[model samples]
Structures are given as structure tokens and as C-alpha cells.
Target chain A: MLMMGAVGLAIARIRDLFAVSMLSGIFSLIGAAAYVVLDAVDVAFTEAAVGAGISTVLMLGTLALTTRKEKLGGGKSKSTTAFLVVAVTGAVLVYGTFDMPRYGDKIAAIHHHVVPRYIEKSGEEVGMPNIVTSVLASYRSFDTLGEVFVIFTAATGVLAILGRARRRREDEEADEGGSDTKGAAS
Target chain B: MMHRKVVLRVVSKFLIPPILLFALYVQFHGDFGPGGGFQAGVIFGSGFILYAILFGVETVKRVLPPWSTRLLLVVGVLTYGLTGVAGLILGGNYLDYNVLAHDPLHGQHYGILIVELGVGITVAASMITIFNVFAGQSGGD
Candidate 1:
């Protein structure tokens, strides 16, 4: 947590976009470590792969397409509004946490419900030793399918937007060549 | 950019196969271990991305062309949906794994394996496709 906070601070202070991206990657790696310590190995694996690996590459790709340095600007109103939003959201979340059970409480509301059944019968029903996999792939297969569709949609959206730009450029170049040929022929 | 570095190239050449092998391991071993389609796919994609970085985008594209990547992306999703459809056709509810085999337990195993494979293929293809698009854009610009 301290490492994450330090990385966050470094990111905020860094004006160089490349450095900031690298720091964020470090931040995610630290977060992944934290998740592992919390015993959520699946979450940690995802955080490490998506957060530190693909995201870092994507950010660097974005930086390549754009600029390495962040634009320097001081917008007092924007900063004030952002502060107000963050403060209100944090306050609401903190208030909500007051009604929540403490971490690792065996008698927590979640543990009392379907979790016990899932833990006990997942092996018999789903026949998987890894309860998480059984729960995700069997009992909660629908949700996983939805998640896959969401990824597919997101990838499609990205391809459509980026591919269109490239194709448009090609079409314009072709148009220019056609006009040049017409002029020469005429 | 690092294509000129022979040391980097040689090391990556050595590294890429193992990375891909690990990805397959993770994909197949997820039911008993700490990985699944998502992580496996990311690992698989990263191997290719590493190859692209060490070699060149054009080289990687030639190996796994954009059109094929796009096709695989669709195929992965289709594979998932078809697995569910097979369940329905076999007199089970949507995505119900029991009917996937004669024995319910074996069916569950087969269902999970097939779906996870679908997930792995889609994820790997999607990541590679996204990377290719982004890299191509940067190069074009």
C-alpha cells in the first residue's frame, strides 16, 4: 500500500508521460503483489497481466502516437471541481463502509449465503478442485460469458475507430492520386 | 527499434517459445491451478508482442497477419457461443455443462475446457489485434 501510494505520488509529480506510464505500471505490479498477499491469486494474475503487461504496452503505444510530455496547464475551476467530486465520493464510500463487516470475519454476510454452498458443493457439482474455477466456469458461467462479450465488443469498438482512421487516410491518398492522373491525362 | 540488437534478438528468440508454452500450460492447467483463459491469453499475446518488439511489427504481421487475427477474434467468440448452444441442443439449459458428455462430471470438465479454450483464443487474438492496430496507427502517424 505504501509502495502504491509512493508510485501514485511519483506519477502525479512526473511531467514526462513516459515516466508516468512506467510508474503506473509499477503501481499495478505493486497492487498485484498486494492482491497475492490477500490470497486472491486469480485477481492478482489478472492485475499483473492486464495492468502491468498489456496496459503498459498500450500506454506506450498511445504515447508514441501522441506526445511524451503532458501539457502544462493550470485550471483552477477544473481542479476545484475535481477535488469536490473526489471528496464527496470518498466521503460517501467511507460512510457506506461503516455498515460493512470487518475484513476476514467468518460470520460476514457474504459467507453466510451462497458462498458456503459454493465452497461445499462446487466440487461435487462442478467437479473442479479449484473452487474459483468451478464457480466462475460452471455456476457463474453466464457472467463469464457476458464478460467475454464485453471484451469482444470493446475490441470491436477499438478496431472500428482506429481502422477507420487508417482507411480514411488511404482513401484520401487514392483520391489525390486519381486527381493527379486526371490532370495529367487532360 | 531494438531489432538491431543481436543480443536482445537472440535472448527473445530463446524466451518466446517458453512464454508460449507457459501460456498453454496455464490455459490447460487452470482448473487445478492458479490460472485460466484470461491470464493464459494475455501471456500468449505478450509472447507475440515480445517478438514484435524484438523483431519488427512488419515481421510479426507477416507471421500472424491482421486479417487472420481478426478472423480468430470472431472464431473465439463463436466457439464460446457454440459450446453453449451445444448444451441447449443436448436437452440442457443454456450453458449447462451436464449434457456435454454422457457423465455429468466429465461433461463439466469438457465444458470448462472448451469454454476456457474459447476464452483463451479470443483474448489472445484480441490483445494481439489491438496491439497491431495501435502499433500500425503510431507508425502511420
Candidate 2:
């Protein structure tokens, strides 16, 4: 967490977009390490892969298309408003954590719920030793299906936007070809 | 593109196969271990992305074209949905693995395996597709 904070600070202070992107990737790697400490291996794996790896690559790609250096100053009022929003959100989140059960409490509301049943019966019912797999793949299969569809939609949306841009460029080239022929005839 | 780095090129060539092997291991071993379709898919996709970075997108495209990626995406989803449909056809609830095989335990095993494979395929294809599209756009290719 301290490492994440330092990386975040570095990212905020950096004016070079490329450096900021690299710092954010470092932040994600730190966050994934934190997740591993919390025993959420699956979430950690995803954070490492998607946040640190894929997102870093994507951000670098965007940086290549845009400027490497960030523009100086968006005005004091904008900064003040952003600070205010962050402060308020952070306060609300901290406040909300007060009502939560203490970490690793066996008798917590969540642990008393369907978790016990899942823990006890998943092996017999789903036949998977890894209860997480049984829960995610069988017990909550519909939700996983929905998640797959979401990914599919997102990929389709990206393809549509990028592919259309390429097609438009091709059309412009075709139009320019006609103009080139007319100029030669003249 | 790091094409000039001979060490990177050779090492990545050596690493890609093992990365892919680990992905398949995670995909199939989720029932017993700490991984599943999602992580496996990401690992698989990362291998391809690594290949693209080291070798160039043109070479990767030759190995796995855009059309095949699109097809795999559809096939993955279809495989998942059809597995559910198969459950229904066998006189069980939608997505219920009980009827997938004569024995309930074996059915659950089969069902989870098949659906996990589906998830892995879709995820890997989607990641590759998105990467290709983004790379192509930025490269203006």
C-alpha cells in the first residue's frame, strides 16, 4: 500500500505522459501485490494482467498517438474542484467502512450466509475441489455468461470504431485518386 | 518494436511456448487449483501479444488472422451457450450440470471443463482482437 501511494504520487507529479503511464503501471503492480497479501489470488492475477500489463500497453499506445508531455496547469479552480471531489469521495468511503465487519471474522454476516453452504456442498454438488471454480462456473454460471457477453460487446465496440476509421481513410484515398486524375488531365 | 534486440527476440521465442503451456495448464487445472478460465485466457493472450511485440504484428497476423480471431470469439460464446442448452435438452435446468452425463459428479466435472474452455477461448480471442485493432490504429496499418 505504501508503495502504491508512492507510485501514485510520482504519477501525479510527472508531467511527461510516458513517465506517468509507467508509474501507473507500477502502481497496478503494487496493488496486485497487495491483493496477493489479502489472499485474493484470482483478483491479484487479474490486476496484474489487466491493470499492469494490458492497460500499460494500451496507455503507451495512446501516448504514441498523442503528445508525450502533458500540458501545464488546467487553472486553480479546476484543481480545487478535483481536490474537493476526491476528498469527499474518500471521506464517504472511510465512513462506510466503519459499519463493516472486522477483517477475517468467522461469524461475519457474509461468512454466515450462502458461503457456508457453498463451502460444504460445492464439492459434492459441483464435484470441483476448488470451490471458487464451482461457485463461479456452476452456481453462478449465468453471471459468468453475462460477463463474457460484456467482453464480447466491448471488443465489438472497439472493432467498430477502429475499423470504421480505416474504412473512412480508404474512402478519402479513393476520392483523392479521382482528383489526382482530373489534375493530370488539366 | 525491439526488433533489433537479438536477445529479446530469442528469449521471447523460447518463452512463448512455456507461457502458452502454462495457460493451458491453468485452464484445465482450475477445478483443482488457484486459476481458471479468465487468468488462463489472459496468459494465452499475453503470449500472443508478446509475439506481436517481438516479431511484428504482420507475422502474428499470419499465424492467427483477424477473421479466425472473430470466429473463435463467436465459437467460444456458442460453446458456452450450447453447453447450457445441452443441459436443458437432457431434462435438467438451464446450466445445470447434473444431466450432462449419466453420473451427476462426472457431469459437473464435464460441464465445468467445457464452459471454462469456452470462457478461455472467448477471452483470449477478445484480448487479441482488441490489441490488434488498437495496434493497427496507432500504427496506421
What would you estimate as the lDDT of candidate 2?
A: 0.90
Candidate 2: lDDT of A89? 100
DockQ of candidate 1 against the true complex: 0.84
lDDT (tens digit, per residue) of candidate 2 on A66-151: 78998998899988999999999999999999999998887788888788899999978887888888999999999999998998
Model 2 agreement with the true structure over B2-114: per-residue lDDT tens digits: 64899999998899999999999999999998889888998999999989977878899999999999999999899899999999999999999989999999999999999
Docking class of 1: high
Question: What's the residue-level lDDT of B59 in candidate 1?
Answer: 96
- Local distance difference test, per candidate? 0.91, 0.90
Which portions of model 2 miss their true places by more than 4 Å?
A183-186, B1-3
Local lDDT at A20 for model 1? 88
C-alpha-based local distance difference test score of model 1? 0.91
lDDT of model 1, residue A71: 85
lDDT by residue for model 1 (A43-151), tens = 8998999899999999999998989998888798998998899999999999999999998888888788789899899889888888888888888889989988888
Write the residue-wise lDDT of candidate 1 on B1-141 in tens digits.
664788988988899999999999999999998999999999999999988877778999999999999899899898889999999999999999999999999999999999999999999999999999999897786
